[model samples]
Target: MVPGFGQNKKAVELYKKAVDALGNRQMPQALDLFHQAVERDTGYTEAYVKLGQVYEFMRQPDQAFQIYQRAIGQQPDNPVTSLAYQSVSAYLLKKGNYQSAIPYIERYQQRFTPNSLQWKKVDRLLQTARFGAQAVQNPLAVRPQPLAATVQAFPSQYFPVLTADEQTLVYTVLKPEGDEDLMVSTQKGETWSPPVSISPQINTVNNEGTPTLSADGRTLVFTACQGRTGYGSCDLYISHKTGDTWSDPKNLGPTINTRSWESQPALSADGRRLYFVSDRNGGVGRRDIWCSELGDDGEWKTPYNLKSINTPFDEASPFIHANGLSLFFASEGHMGMGGYDLFVADSTSSGWSNPQNLGYPINTSDDQAALFVSANGARAYYSQEQSASDGKQRSKLYVFELPEPLRQKVRPVSYLKGMVADARTKKPLNATIELIDLATNKLVTRVQSDPQTGQYTAVLPTGGEYALYVVGPGYLFKSLSFDFTKKHEGEGLTMSVPLEPIKPTEGGAPAKETLNNIFFETGRYDLADKSRTELDRLVKFLEVNPDVKIEVSGHTDNQGGVANNLDLSKKRAQAVVDYLAKAGVAPARIKSAGYGETRPVAPNTSEENRKLNRRIEWKIL
Candidate 1:
């Protein structure tokens, strides 16, 4: 046995007796002997360590922690004082005593080489302590209120997700049978209805949880463990909502799942991009966030690691907002309050920005995950556990208003809800609807209207103008535009698109309709850059129907001189013809016409009427 400095023979005898008692599992006897040995020789580090270990084994961390502290005070100059400091620092850090742990870690750091592994480990612990201490001093003004009782009927519920409209909610519940299942509820006025099993096909005897939905609430991606068809310990499965019934779930296939672990999926508003947690090979950590894009051919491509947001520690519970810019997730690696803390990162033109902690009270020593933010960025929802009066732990959903300062950091979003129908028959048609950013000429989102109901929804993030297109087979595509560059109340818009059929008119001539998205400078024939999105759609239409010939015409509202109007209209019509020719349209199949102020569709008595009269129209020949 090593000598205890100060060398008391009686103390050494007591320490040996205590070790034998501990070996025989006589915890109380060991505790009494250790206390006697430490009292005889206050400089006995071995006696103190044994006594602290007994307390820790009994799950009395406070007592164990105090024992370590006393040992350090009794032998501040002893050779083994570093061990006492290290032990005390670990207990303090675990208890969130950051300020007290810092000095201990600094002292312990001095016991090793400058660049040694032990020193580096202690240095990281010191940094974590300092970061957590600062975070406690500055906390977000957040007051989380429990969700409506009807939605919290289950004893335990978590991982809540809402549709873009906030009318539908879905979450996971832990059943008493030791398995998880999905539950859903719909909003009725200010309160939510009682939740029910999402679908018979979704919940199995095994487990199904951690669900995410598309903005329209039509697509579901969730995790299932120990499934017969699973590619991993847990794999993501997809389902589609057709009318009121959900289709059967299908595995996402090998590109997204492996023989490792995968769960907690977050999908883009259009269901084109998928973010999920996986422990597959080549990950930055034991578990990391991976992303995959859905190709146009309707297949999920191979996933790639999100290195910018992932760290050498575990990360999980990713939630990508409808705006597609702000991403909220939980990470154990980032400087946070103990376990898993929530964070938000923004995707910019220069890639992802450094993640910002969501701040205290919003986060705590306990693990926090699965945070859901509203489309407007004004409200947030999450799950938290609280001790009830009965001394049982219960988890429930919560909601809080995100402060305006943080609101501005996230891009707000609004959704467009509508239906697509044939103009003549008024019958629902399954059509492809796309929202394209006019400024950048990029497709923002694409969705398909339900075949039976003709209903569709698309998310429109604030900033810039967009061109909305609805295209279906054997039908003339509908074109519309919206400008949201300025701030406005984040309310949804409703539109019903009526598509005309591709057929000859009764008079053996093609029908004429105005193209509302085409733009030009005042009195100038040069097309604005925003006009390309519309012109490109026109090019695609002509390319698909190669045998058809069309006439492009421009009209004026009689605001300028009739002679000038006629000349300006002729030049504008020629400009459309030139663009079509450049896009590979047969020049012989196109013609330009100028019908100036003479043929005004609306009376030019008001600005709105004049706006309607100045348009570009197309007629099939």
Candidate 2:
């Protein structure tokens, strides 16, 4: 038996009684007997440690920590006090009291054995302590208020998604038997209607969580588990809302959802890219965020892992704001208050930036995840567990205003919505609408018109000019441009398109059309690699009209001397002629000319018109 003190007979007797009470699981009695033993002998190390053990059992961490502190003071070099440093630092660090835990960890390091395996963990805990101390000193005032009873009722509610107009709310509610279903409510001013189940096509006996909606609110994507045809235990599924009814849900296929686990779909504003959580394999973390972009061919490309924002620990629940630059997610990998702290990361052309913790009050020792922010970055919504009147714990959704410093990076965005119809019949037609950034000639997004209604909408992120192409079978592809340069919040544009039917002699007219597809580098007439796509279209057009001859002309803005502009323009026209001749077009049927700055379609004062002035035109001869 370990002696309680050097030579106190009554203290020894009291230690024996305390040990009996502790063995019987009587924590309060054991605590009092141990306290009495320590009073009889102030240097009683055994009694002090036993008192701490009793306090720890009673869930009194502060008293337990004080017991260890007193033991260390009485016997500075004792092994019992040295080991107690681990528990004291743990309690302080877990509560985010980093400054108080710092000295306790340092004292532990001095007396702890170098070969002990716990030193490595102690080092990590110490670093987290230092980080938390600084982060909490200047915390944001985050006051989250529970949503109204109309939206949150019964078993549980979470994962709220708001539309671009902020008039609709879509979310998920957990039912018994571990199943989840999507629910929706409409906003009438500040009050929301009672939420109703979205659609029977999406609800099933299986589990579904983390529902995300497209910018137009026509497409719905979510997670499903234990799927019959899924490669993994869980998979992502999608549904299309047509006319007031939703189509049957379809799995995203092997390109996106693998055999491990996938959930939490976050669709981009443009509806061309998807950000989700997956833990299949070959990722930096156990459960990391991955992305899959829509291809021009109408198929999803292979998903890629987000390397910069993921770590060895688990990461999940990605919510991309309407600004498209800020990303928020839940992570156990990034060091924070404790279990699953919410983090935010800014995006760039190259990749994502390093993640930053959302700070103290917004994040706590308890699990804080499933966060969603509005497009304007003004408000955010999240879910938390609270005790119900029935004494059962239930999760509910809440909303709060975000600090301005956090919303500084929110990008103002504008969207273009329209429908596709036939010019001759004036009837809706199924078509593919593709958007290209004229500044970079890069494909921005590709959305398909609803087969029945021909209605389509896509986000035009930020204020820039974009080319929208509408293509369908047995019809000529119609190209148009929309300028959002002056667009801001509470602003949007609406326009309808009419496609021309491809008749036998329709394009054989002597009328001239600008070759808007051709692209050239600044101050150089050399064609770019992507310009091949446009030239190929011309090749097909010529093949259809074998007997027709055309004259190719080039024009430029009136910026340089006439002599220099004529030379440059002629070179550009001949480049098209050369390409046609190389592609087996008879040399006698093609002619090249340089119009220079003589044909001014639009004034060159503004940059948009200047871009319109620099172009190639073809006329039937």
Candidate 3:
């Protein structure tokens, strides 16, 4: 039924006059008529709605909001409630009056059929209001400060990223000429050195921005548009850092990039997994986040949309932290205060958890993008517009101490930075490095030492034992173990690795080195489950050199009686031999020995030295 259908003829006539006055652009006359019409018949819904519309036309949203509320209150079951609910909710939400918007949003949700498209839209709005109210009530403890003037040299800078050690910073600079380029800076003691062009090969006359760096800072993946060979409007390009120079850029290829749009790349610490944004078909949103993995053949596989983290709205600027579990991105769909709030989601055993808005004041009514978190979970960097010293607005990088509440949600990480060199020559060697989680027998990360300098850095999330393997052509692969399952302090560990060549010895003795990663339970000869990763590496080594015969020796730290130690060591060596034989290695090509207590690599004094004493060693026979 038409609102006020036979109830108030005089009010209806006044509303008609008010509508005519509004058509004539007589604002004062229309307001006076609307007020008289609503006053003449308090329950006339049409008169009230017309009054509110006139108030809205006059740019008085507060008055219009009050008028709409009165119309709904006076006629709760009137058919006009739908329009009133939508109008009031929109104004309240736009004004960030989320607390006031909630009740109207609930009523708005009721007007549509359940599960209909309209209902889903309203449902999302309700969630946004609820989340916004809660966020306003409890803001994250953060105060973002602008980066050093040296680093923010340009009028516009954004998309900041850092190396695993937090020593190197990279970001996109919107130059005064309007072309974007990647800029880089190195951290001095307390301040950053002035930023310069990242590389001539990576930056071009075209646009090159939204760069992501591998934890080691050796691999860079970024977005480039125009003036380049591309598969889309903008496509991802990759470059490698060897010694101190960056290699020429290459497109990521069509398997990951499409004729549509693909940009904003985020690389895993190892550079094996890539996450980015795309507007291609098969996405849940107009622009969705997608991921691809580097195959064993070193090719990126077909990209799959990150459906769990993406919504029916755009998601951009994904940052896979050094720990590789926490994912930070910008989104317009998720429940938030307003436009493009920053959100974080964690990859769990099952899948990615629901994204949580980073919350106010880390988020606000304005859009937030390109958030970078430190490996230790201590700092976060993002881009925001601020008035410069010249009193003109510019986009600059701001950093803040990550809150303790959020810090607990992510794993703290450290890194191993070092050089891979030849043992005999003490010269740099290009080698592939892998870090494997011993507990799960899964590769934690993989990286490559720079071909020229042999420099490498591997990220290690705390609370796990790891097997580190270094492999290069014509070199005997090296293995080492790190036990970080217990609480440990420090930003990272550093060491130099010297790998021996896989050649016959000069003949003082057979070539030998301790296998630091092999594991055996105390007082037992059975191989623990965690030993499989190391054993598998050994098996592969033997397979590659099928003609070589080898001896596996076990040692003890002299803590036990000589007889018991000898027996234990011998059984352990035999166990390894048995595993190799079972794995298809010829029994005749292997020998087992027990050098218990007699062949200690280090004196059996401190626990650390004693640990070195009890180990498995392999020698070419």
User: Which model scores highest in TM-score?
Assistant: 1
Deviation of model 2 at 128, angstroms: 2.7
TM accuracy, model 2: 0.75
TM-score of each: 0.91, 0.75, 0.84
Runs of candidate 1 exceeding 4 Å displacement: 1-3, 6-11, 23-29, 35-45, 77-84, 389-392, 488-490, 504-513, 547-551, 586-609, 619-621
Between candidates 2 and 3, the lDDT winner: 3
Error of 2 at 398 (Å): 3.5
Per-residue lDDT of model 2, residues 1-621, tens digit only: 377346488998999999999999988889889989989998888788788888899989899989988877787667767657878888887777789988888778776467477776666677777777877887887888888889986599888887766667898898766678888988998888999888978887767778998876778899888644677888998888876789898899989977788899999866678999988888997889998988868689999988999898999899887667788999987888767889999898787888888987888766786788776567888888888899887899899988766756566555556788877677888888777776677667767777778777765666676677777776656666656667554245577877665543554544456677777898789987656656665676677778767898999888877887888889999999999989888889889999888887999898889888888988767
- How would you order the candidates by TM-score, starting with the best? 1, 3, 2
* Weakest 10 consecutive residues of candidate 1 by summed lDDT: 504-513
Cα displacement (angstroms), candidate 2, residue 38, comes to 6.0
Error of 1 at 155 (Å): 1.7
- Residue 47, candidate 1: Cα error in Å is 2.8
**What tens-digit string does per-residue lDDT give for candidate 1 at 1-621?**
365656689998999998999899999999999999989988788788778888877778889888887877776656566667777887777777788888888888888899799888888778878887887787778888999999988778999999998889999998767778999999999989999999998998988999999998999999998765988789999999887889999999999989999999999999899999999999899999999999999999999999999999999999999999899999999878778989999999999999998877787767887799989888999998879898777889999999766787788898998889988778998999999998889999999888888899899878889888999988778888788988554668888988877784465446556787899999999999889889888899988988778899999998999999998888999999999999999999999999888889999999989988888888777
